[model samples]
Target: MKCLQEQAADGTHLLFLAAVYKLLYLLYTKDAATVDHVLRHRSRRDFERIEQSMQYVKRNYTNPITLKETADELSLTPEYFCRLFKKYTGQTFLTYVNQIRLQYFHSDLLQTDESITYLMNKNGITNYKVFLRSFKEAYGMPPGQLRKKQREVRDAGAISARSASSSGND
Candidate 1:
């Protein structure tokens, strides 16, 4: 890519970073949505409050956290905090909390045999419809279908491994 060559002229180390950025730029250009999403992740000024809010969300996502409470912690009014949070994070406070909850939900979904309803409750995801929509948007499939597919893949892998071992013995 032209981007990489420009960086390569600077130094060899920069060439690797240039390649990565070039790929990222291509991805960003190909998908308008990705460009929007990536732009939101850029570091902004007054990031201390944003970082604090993110830490609070990470620590308290399993519980019911409110915007007012988070704002109060940062000595900002709810309205100002809401604006600042959205400006820096590209998502609403509630949506950020749900994203964290969904992350843990996804991990537990793959690692445990618990029921989805129980997992939802544990993750503080109260609205099934919204959660389902968000889940599908994030994962490209419904939870039940994803779980079923993973099970089938795991079972098939085990069967293949067993066959290989038995054939080796023979």
Candidate 2:
């Protein structure tokens, strides 16, 4: 009570008061084991929705995915869905979708010898410039460079193992 009174007396401390009010509001409104339980319940539901959307995107990354469609699937308004998604996942819906698409692209790069143009097209990225920029920003390297380096590392390991085996045999 004294802290609250002191906080109310000062304008700068009002922000802390507001934060405390919000926390109390949440605490009074919900009942569970702990704050972690409340948060984890919310997170689990959001992640289940995210996982469903991710699966859909994985199957349809080569096609258009409007926010409306995803929101509808999750039974949320587009605006609210976007806000909740960003709050829980730290990325906008489209950005998270692109991240999933990029993961697919990364998997392909690791497993297949597909050309970058093919990848961009396969992933429904028509703009080469935008694809390169987003891919590099997300993965910290151009797709081509990443694949090249991965190949080099794989080959070097194979060569080292072969050399070791031959020396041991001799």
Candidate 3:
């Protein structure tokens, strides 16, 4: 019985090692064939499901979008929705929502003179510190710094264009 137990343990370890090896192999290969296979075989139902989820994300970014809300929209359980979302989009729902918020924030920085605090409040970001940290992580710079840099670039470009037009007139 002891020997049988030891053999079972060894078998489990071997299975774990095999799984690790297979994962490494897939990563090394970049697995284009499998990815293409999945994409090519994706059905209309899959596309419709993803489209609905994306629409929900876009429309509700400034609101508290719970997993339950998304799951209900798709008639899926939260767990199943999470798994399907990650599998199809290579991003979890929370990560995807943050990406959308970051994109919206970046555009607002370029186009508007809104206060950062106001933007945070408007975007459902309650924690200023966490918002700053996550924004910096996503954008490689603080929001204020990015806004300042964008303004400088825009001003410089405008000045250069004006000078070039004057030179052409001369």
How well does each candidate superpose onto the true structure, as a TM-score? 0.70, 0.66, 0.68
- The 10-residue segment of model 1 with minimum total lDDT is 37-46
Scored by lDDT, model 1 comes in at 0.88
Report how far residue 17 has shifted in candidate 3, in Å: 41
lDDT per prediction? Answer: 0.88, 0.82, 0.83
Ranking by TM-score: 1, 3, 2
Tens-place lDDT digits, model 1, residues 59-151: 888788899999998888999899988987898988899999999999899889999999999888889999999999999999988888999
Winner of 1 and 2 under lDDT: 1
Question: What stretches of model 1 exceed 4 Å from their correct place?
Answer: 1-45
Pairs of colliding residues, candidate 2: none
On lDDT, the candidate that comes out on top is 1
Best by TM-score: 1
Per-residue lDDT of 68-155 in model 3, one digit per residue for the tens? 8998999989998898888889989888887787778777777889998777666666667767888899879999998899889999
Poorest 10 consecutive residues of model 3 by lDDT? 38-47
